[model samples]
Target: MSAGDLSGRRALVTGAASGIGRACAVRLVEEGAAVVAVDQDADGLAELAKTVDVEQSVVDLSQLNDVDRLDLAVDIVVNNAGLQHVAPIQEFPPDRFSYILRVMLEAPFRIVRGALGHMYAGGWGRVVNISSVHGMVASPYKAAYVAAKHGLEGLSKVIALEGADHGVTSNCVNPAYVRTPLVENQIASQAKAHGITEDEVIERIMLERAALKRLIEPDEVASFVAYLCSDAASSITGSSMRMDGGWTAH
Candidate 1:
C-alpha cells in the first residue's frame, strides 16, 4: 500500500504518549489510520490527543491483568511500552525484572491474543514490536531490559509463524540509542555504571558500537515502521529490521 493508503484501518499503539511511540501514532494518522493511543501518562496522552484524532487509554502496561483486559480488536498493533533499569544481574531487583517482562513481553502477548481473532476474521493484521539492539546482543547493567526484549523477539516470531496463513504479519524493529526521553534518562545511569562522564557516555559508550556516531530520530524509526505496515511489506514477517546505525553489523 502507498502512503495514506490506510484510510479505513484501525491501529492500537502502546506507549503512544511520547518519543518513538508518539511519532508512530502521528505517522499512522497521516497515513489515514484511526489510532488508539495507549500509555500510562495521563498528561502525555492528553498532549498527544491535542495533536491527533486518537482514542486514548491511560493504563500501566506492567499491570498484567489490566493488559489482558485491554480492547485490542484493531488492524495494526504496535507494542512499544517499555522501561529500563540499569544494574548488573546480581544487583538487579527481582521485582523490577518481572515488571519489565510483564510490560515488554507479556503485555504484547496478551494484546496480540486479544486482537488475533478480529484480525483473522478480517483477513489482515500487522504486529510491529519496537525492540532494541539489546534484543539481539548483550550489554552490562541492563539485564531486565535485555531479557525482556529478547523474549519479545521470540514472541514476535511465533506470532508471525502462526498468523502467516491468516494474512497477519508480525515483525520487530530494533533500534540502538535513539534521541528520546528514555535515552536521556539513561545517560546519568549509564555514566555511573561505566564510570564515565556524561559526554563520554554518549561518545565513547552509546555511539561506540555504532558505525554512525549519532542518535537516531524517532521519526526515522516511525517511517520504517510505516513501511512495514504497507502492502509492500506483505512478504516480510518473522524478521527483525535493524535501525541501529550499524551497531549490529559489528
Candidate 2:
C-alpha cells in the first residue's frame, strides 16, 4: 500500500511508550496518520515523541476514570496496553488480578465505547486489539492475562457485529511471545516459576508450541495492524488473526 494511504486519519494507541504499541504508533505515522500515543511511562513517551510526530498522553490506563475522560474520537483505536502476572490460580494475588482486568479488559471497553459514536457517524473505523495466543487457548500460571485476553476476544467480536452495518470493524491480532521489554523482563520469572534456566525459558516455554522457534518482532505485529486498517481489509472483521508462527495450527 502507499505510504499516504491513511492520510487525514487519526489513531489512538494505548501502551504506546514501548513494544508492540510503540511500533504500531510509528507504523501508522509512517502511513500518514496522526497518532495519539498514550502510556504511563513518561520517559519512554518522551523518547517516542522525539522519534515520531504524535500527541503524547501520560495517562495510566489502569485508572478507568482517566480512560473514560480521554478524547477518543479517532478513526482507529488500538487497545494494546496490557500487563502479565503469572501465578497459579490458587496463589494469584486478588488485587493484581483485579488490576489486570481493569487495564486489559475494562479500559479497552471504555476506550472503544468513547470512540464508536464518532466511527459510526463517519461510517468508517478500525479497532485492532493486541491480544495474545492466550485469548484462544489456556496456558498454566497466567490466570489473569488469559482471562482478560479471552474477554477482549469476545468484546472484539461483539463490536464487530454491532458496528458492521456502520462501517466499523473490530478484530484481534494474537501473537506468540514478541521480542519486547515485557517478554524480556519475564524471562527470569518464567525460568524460576518453571524450574528452568533463563536460557531455556524461551526455547522450552515460550516457543515450545510454535513450529517456528523464535520470538516475533514488534514491527511484524505492527505491519498486521496497519494492514487491518487498510482498505484491503474492509471485509475482515470479527476475526482473530494469528501471527503465532504455527503455534495454533496444532
Best by TM-score: 2
Colliding pairs, model 1: 1-231
RMSD of each: 1.5, 1.4
Best by lDDT: 2
lDDT of 2 by residue, 1-250 (tens): 3334898899999999999999999999999999999999999999998999999998999898899889998999999999998788999999999999999999999999999999999999999999999999999999999999999999999999999999999999999999989999899887887898977999987899999999999999999999999988999999999999999999
lDDT of 2: 0.94
- Model 2 lDDT at residue 8: 86
Which stretches of model 1 miss by more than 4 angstroms? Answer: 191-197
Query: What range of 10 consecutive residues in model 2 has the weakest lDDT sum?
Result: 1-10
lDDT, model 1: 0.92
**What residue runs in model 2 are displaced by over 4 Å at the alpha carbon?**
1-4, 192-197
Each candidate's lDDT (Cα)?
0.92, 0.94
lDDT of 1 by residue, 54-137 (tens): 999988998888887778879999999889998878988999999889999999999999999999999999999999999999
After TM-score superposition, the amount by which residue 208's alpha carbon in candidate 1 deviates from its true location, in angstroms, is 0.5
